[model samples]
Target: MNQPGEDFYCDEALSGRTPVTVVAETADVLAFEHTRPFWPVHVVVVPKRHVPSLTDLGEADEALLGRVLAVVRQVAADVEREHGACRVLTNLGRYQDSKHLHFHVCSGAPRHPDTD
Candidate 1:
């Protein structure tokens, strides 16, 4: 079973079918508030173009990868500046429920919501 907001970014956000609380965006990257945030300051950063995982990045994706990381860096800075500290991470292999390449920028305590 697909957990409520699991893979929500690919299933909805990227498709533009579901409105997201966007925090930042560039031509190739998007950083937005998690639809169902598990952490107090959870934000998702992704490339507008689908790339499966960080390990899957190829030479052809060099420019796109740079753009994605740039957005990730900025989002993390903003979060840390306000929240004191932040964690920037990406899930891989079995830990990655969503196949799309994305970075999680989070801080503070988790909200502990039932939906997540």
Candidate 2:
């Protein structure tokens, strides 16, 4: 279970409130290890500049979205290379605990087998 703080990805990871193990990053995007990984291999990707959610994207967000997707593609490729399969996901609405726009790249077994 990834016990993310009350802060969203922006306030936690981007603003440096929470230290993160960075996987990849560009001036406008970042991919880092999940704070508390649910899966054996879990990583989080987000735009350095805050975008609220997927539905909130605009034409001005295209460039940043491209950069974020590029990073997600690379990370997913790496995960699938080792695990044989990987899942990329983005949650919206009530499912989204954090309001920040982000992607999840994950694979393998659960980190904590005890949890459902």
- Go through the candidates in order and give the clash count of each: 0, 0
Q: Rate the local accuracy (lDDT) of all candidates.
A: 0.85, 0.84
lDDT of 2 by residue, 72-94 (tens): 99999999998899999999988
Alpha-carbon RMSD, each predicted model:
3.8, 4.3
TM-score of 1: 0.86
lDDT of 1 by residue, 1-116 (tens): 34555655667898898889999999888999988788989999998866778998633378898899999999999999998999999999899988778999999887766655
Candidate 2 has which clashing residue pairs, if any?
Answer: none
| TM-scores for candidates 1 onward, in order | 0.86, 0.86
